[model samples]
Target: MRNLHKIKLLYEKYLNRTATHEEVEELFMLLRDRNQFQHIHNIMEDEWERNDIDFSVENLSWEKVRSEWPTEQKISDVREMPIEKHAIWSLKIRKIVAVAAGVLIAGMMLWWWTKTNTKEYRTGFGETMEIVLSDGSRVLLNANSKMTWNTNWQNIQERTVQLEGEAFFEVSHQRMPVNNSSPDQKDSISLMPFQVITSDLSVNVLGTSFNVASRRQKTDVFLKSGEVLLVAKPPLPRSKNDEKKTAGPSLAKHMDSIYLTPGDHITYSGITRALERHEEKLPDEPTSWVDGFLVYENEKLETVLQELKDIYGKSFIMEDSTMLSRQVDLGLPYEDWYTVSELMSLSLEIEMEENNSEITVKKLEK
Candidate 1:
C-alpha cells in the first residue's frame, strides 16, 4: 500500500510535466513490465468504461481534469450510496482492493496522457504540408516527410524535434524565457543549435533556412541562407577476428564535414564515403518543386527523364545512349506532360513521340 502511494505521486509528477528524465524512464519501465502492470491496466480499463467521463480529452492532458471535475460533482450530487458498517471478515480484503484500484487508476491516467499528448506530424507521398509552431517558427515539409516533438514544449529546457525526409525551416529569432533553475545564466540562444539528424549525418544551425534530403540511400544538405554545420558519422570499428583477415593497412580518416556558404549544396554518399559540394550557379532550381515548378538547367537528358517519370508518371526509352547523354539546358514548366515534352523538344532540337504513353526521344538526323 505504501509503494502504491509512491507510484501515484510519481504519476502525478509525470502528468504535471515536473518529473525528472530518470523518473519518466522509470515510470515507462514499470508500465512495460507486464507481470506487474497488466492486471492493473485491465481493471482500470473496465472502470473507465463504466464512468460517463469523456476519455478522449481526458486522455490528452491533465488540464481537462480541473474543468471536468465541477461537472462530475454536479452529476454525483444526484446519486447516493448506502452507508454500511464494514464486516470484520471482509474489511482487510476491501482495503487491499481499494489501494490496488487507486494504483491502477493512476497508471492508466499516465499511460493515456503520454500517448495522446505527444505531437507527431507526417506527410504522405506526393503531399506537402506547412506547420506553424507555437514559437512562431514555420516549417515546410516536403513529400514523404515526418516530424515529431514532445508536447511539453513550453516547459522543456530546449525545443527539439526528430525529422525524416526533407523540410525547410524559418525559425523565429525570439529566445524562450529561461526558468530560474537553468544552470546557464548567460543567454546561450546562439549556442543552442537546432538539429536535423539523418541516418548518416546531422546538420546543426542556430537560425537559418536550409533544405535537407535524408532518404535511406542519399543524404543531401543545401544552405540557402545563414550558416550551418554538418557532422557525419565516424566509421565503425572493425572486430578483432576480422581485423587480421582484412589486409588494407590502416584506414584513412574520412572528411566528416564541409561547411557550405549560401547557394552551396553538399551530398554525402554513404557507399563511397565521399562528400561532394557543388556551387549553385544560374537557374538555382533544386527546390523549385516547392513552388510548383520543375526547373532544370544543363541537366543530363537521362536525369531529366528520371525526374519526369517520378513527377508525371511518364516513362521513356532511349534507343541510343549517346543521344541520351546530350546535356540540355532548359526550364520546362511543371503544368502538364505535353507542355514539358514540347518545351524539352524545342530546346534540344529533338522529336518526342508518345507510343502507348511512353515517351521516346530521337535526335534529328538532319
Candidate 2:
C-alpha cells in the first residue's frame, strides 16, 4: 500500500512538470517492475478517468496490452523524454503515456513469469533427497545431482524433466486426450509419455520405476520395473542445412533407440557415442542404495571405491596397482561409514588408512 502511494505521488509529480530528472528516472524504474503491475494499472486508470479519456470504446485493460506486447523489447529503454510545460495537459499526451505504461509493464511480466515458473532441485555431495512432484511422481535424487522441470504441468503436453547426475524415478501415470484424432475418436484418452533427458540420451517411459546415472562422460540406465525406451540424441550439425535436416523426424527416427525390461542395464559412452547392454542377473536389489545401503556383488574394487567416494565425499588411493583388479561382494549401510571402511579393508585383505577424507590402501604383510 505504501509503495502504491509512493508510485502515485511520483506519477503526479511527473505530470505536473515539477519532477526533477532523477525523480522521472526513479518513477520509470518503479513502473518497469512486474510485481507492481496492478498498482501501476490502478494509478493509470484513475488518471485516465480524471482526464476524461474514453477507455470503454477501446476496451483497453492491462491484460489486452500484455497479450499484444512485444516480447523481444526491453521496458527499461522506454524513458520519459523532456517535453514543454504547454504539452503537459494535452489530452493526446496523457493517452499516449497510459498506453506506453501498460505495454512496458507487460514486457517485464512475460520475462518474470517464465523465470518464476521453472523449478530446480539439487543435492550436495554426500547428500540425498526425495522429491514429490506436482504430478504425484517421486524422484530419489542421489548425491551431487540436479533436476529441473516446469511446474506448470497442466499446460504442458509432455511430462518432461532434465536430469544431471543420478536419480531414481517412480513416474505417475497420466491419461491425456490424444491430439489430432478423428471426430469419432476425439474422446479417446491415452497414456502420456514421461521423459527424463540427459546430455546424450532421452529415457521415455509411461509410468515406470528406474535409475539413471549420467556422469564421467557416460550414462547408465537400470530398469527396476516396468518398461523404458532409450533414445540417443543426434550429434551437433556442422552446417545450417544439416541442422534443419536433423530437426525433421527422419533424422531423429534413424537415431539409435533401445528398449529395456526389468533387470536390464545399458551403458552409453559419451566419448564413443555407443551403447553396451548387459543382460546378466543383477546382484540382490540393485537399487538398495535408495534405501540407504550400498549393495553390490562381484563388482570391481575400483567401481566400489568410486561409489564410496560419491556417498562419503572421500578419495581412495591404491598403493598397489594390483588392487584395481580386486572384486568386492558386500552390503554396507550408509550411516556406518567407518565400519564399512573397516569391513572393506578386511574383505580385500589390504591395509586401509584414513586421513581426513582420503583413504590410502596398501597390501597387507603376511
Candidate 3:
C-alpha cells in the first residue's frame, strides 16, 4: 500500500507535464497495468451508462472496428474535425475512422486526480491573452503561442514551463514559499529555480521578467530584470552498438552558454551554433507588441511576416519570388487581420489577397 503513494505522485507529475523522461515511460507502464486498466474501464463504463451514451463497440474486434467505423453520421458529429488532406479515398476514410475510434480508446485509458492542478494556456491566431500562474507569476502570451505548466508549482522541485512561439513573463519573487507544506517543518529548503524551455534554448532564472520569441530554429530572449542563463541543447548520447560502427572523433569540444542581466538581449542561432547579442540600451521595442502595436527596426520582410503571424495567429504566403532580404521599418497596429494586411500591402507596395485566415501577397503589375 505504501507504494501506492509513489504511484499517485508520479501519475500526478505526468499529468502536469513535469515528470522526467524516464518517469513518463514508467507512468505509461503503470497505466497499462491490468488492475489499473480495469479500474479506469469500470469508471468510464459507469459514466457512459449514466449519460445514456452509445458505447456498444467496447467489445468489438479491431477488424470489425475498421470495417464499420466512419459512418456518415459520425463524421459530421465531431465538433472540431481533423484537417483532411487530399489523399486516396480508401486511405482517407480509414484515417478518419481510426481517429474516431482512437478517441473512445483514449477516453477509457485516462486517469487524473485533480483537473484544477494542471492548466494549459493557449492563444489562437490573432488573439493575445494573459494569465497568472500559481506562484503569482504573470504571463502574457502573444498570438499563436502556448504555455503549459502545473498549477501546483510551489510544491514541485522547480517552477518550469514548456513554451512555444512568443510571450512576456513577470515572475513573482518569494523564498521557499512551499504550498500545502506543514508549518512545523524542520529543515528549510531554498527556493527552486525557474526555467522556460524551448527546443533550441533553455532560460533559467530564480526571479526575473523577460520576453522570449522562439521560431525558425532560433530563440530570442530579452531580459528586463534580474538575470538569466541561456544554454544550448546538447547532443544526445550515442548508443554503444552505434558507437562500434565507428565515427572518427567528436566535432565540438564544449557546449555554449550565455548570461544576461537587465536590458540585455541574446539570440541563439539553431543553424550555425552562433550566439549573437545586441547591447543597446534596450527600449520597450522587444515587448511593445503587448500594447497592440508592432515595432520593427530594419527587419527583413520574412521576419516582419513572422511577427504578423505571432499577432494574427494566421499565416502568409508569397506568391511571387521576392527578395526575402528586403528590409522594412514600420509600426502598425495589430487590431484586425484586414487592417494589418492593408498596412502590409501599402507599406510593401504589394497586392494582398485574404481568404479566410490565409493571406497571399503578390507583386503588382507595372
Candidate 4:
C-alpha cells in the first residue's frame, strides 16, 4: 500500500510551490484512491478558507459554474474581477475552486438524470391498469403495485422495467426494415431483450407472455407462453445475519441463468436469493383478470372477499368467520359495481348484506 503520509507531505510541498513535477505526479496517483477523495476535499476546503477568498464572490462563482456546466457555454460572472490587484484570486485557489465546481456539477447532473429518465406506473387498491408502451407492448399492472421504466424506451434496443408488484406483460415483436443497398442482404433484426426486474430476479424474454408478482419480499414469475430466462441478482431483501446494505449502485452479478419453457413458474426468495422452478399447467383463469374478470377457484370466501376489497376499495367482514374460510369458486366481472355483491351472493348461494363500507356473508339456509 502507498503510504498516506507521503501523499500528505507531497500535497503540502505542492501548496508551498516547492514540489518537483515527480512529487506532483505521485500526489495525484495517491488521490486516485477513493478513500483519499474525501481527505483531499477536506484539504481543498481548508485551503479555500485559508486564502480568504470573498464568500459572496465564491458563491456567485459556483452558481454561475453550476448553471453553465451542462451546456459547456462560458459565462462571465465567475471570471469577472474587481479593479484592486489584492482582490484577485491566486492560481492555486482558482484551480481548487474549478475542480470543486466540476465535482458539484457532476453530482447534480447524475441526480437530475436519475430523476428525469424514469417514469412510474402505479395502481391503487384493487385497481388494474393497462399501460401501452412506446414499443407497442402492453402491461397489465395489478393492484397496489408500482412499476418503473425508462421514458426514452424507443431509443434503446433492450427494454427493462422494474417491478414491486404483480404485472402481466405481452412483449412486442420487432422486425428490422429491409436494406436495399445490397441485393443479397438477409433480414437481421436482433432479438430485442426485454427484462422485468424485481428485487431478486430479472425475468428476460424476447417475445412472450408472462406474469410477475412480487409481494412480501418474494418474487414469482409465471410463463404463460413462449420462453423466459431468469437471472438472479443478490443482496436480496434483508434477513437475519445475512443482511447487507441495500443503498448502492445495483450492478447485476448474475451467478447463473435458469431457462424456462412455456408453462414454467419460478419463485425467488428476497432473503436467500435462492430460486426454485416448477412446471405448471398454465391456465387461462389466472390471467382472466386482465380481460375484466376476476376468477376464484376454490379459494376461501374470505380470500375472495379480500380480492373484492382490493378491486372496489370496500371493507369486507364475515359475521360467520368460519364461513369466510369456506371454499368459494366464482368469476366476478368488473362491470356492474352496484350489483356485484348481490350477484356474487346469489351465485354462491349465500346471503351477503352490505352496510356502507362493510360486506357481511352468511349461509343462506341459516
TM-score of candidate 3 relative to the true fold: 0.58
- Mark the regions of model 3 whose C-alpha exceeds 4 Å error after superposition: 1-117, 177-191, 235-256, 269-272, 279-282, 363-366
lDDT of 4 by residue, 235-307 (tens): 4333332222122333556344566667767678857766665543336655677788877776777767765
TM-score pick, better of 1 and 3: 3
* TM-scores of the models, in the order given: 0.55, 0.64, 0.58, 0.58
Taking every candidate in turn, the Cα RMSD to the unseen true structure, in Å, is 14.4, 10.5, 16.0, 14.7
Clashes of 2: 0
Off by over 4 Å in 4: 1-103, 124-127, 154-156, 175-189, 234-256, 267-282, 353-360
- Cα lDDT, model 3, residue 196: 91
**Distance from true position, residue 245, model 2, in Å?**
25
lDDT of each: 0.62, 0.74, 0.68, 0.68
TM-score of 1: 0.55
Q: Could you tell me the lDDT of residue 135 within candidate 3?
A: 82
Clashes of each: 0, 0, 4, 2
Comparison by TM-score, 1 against 4, better one: 4
lDDT of model 2, residue 318: 88
Error of 3 at 298 (Å): 1.4
Over 36-143, each residue of candidate 1 has an lDDT whose tens digit, in order, gives: 454444444444444432243225444543443335554454233233422432343333343344455556756765565567888765557889877667888776
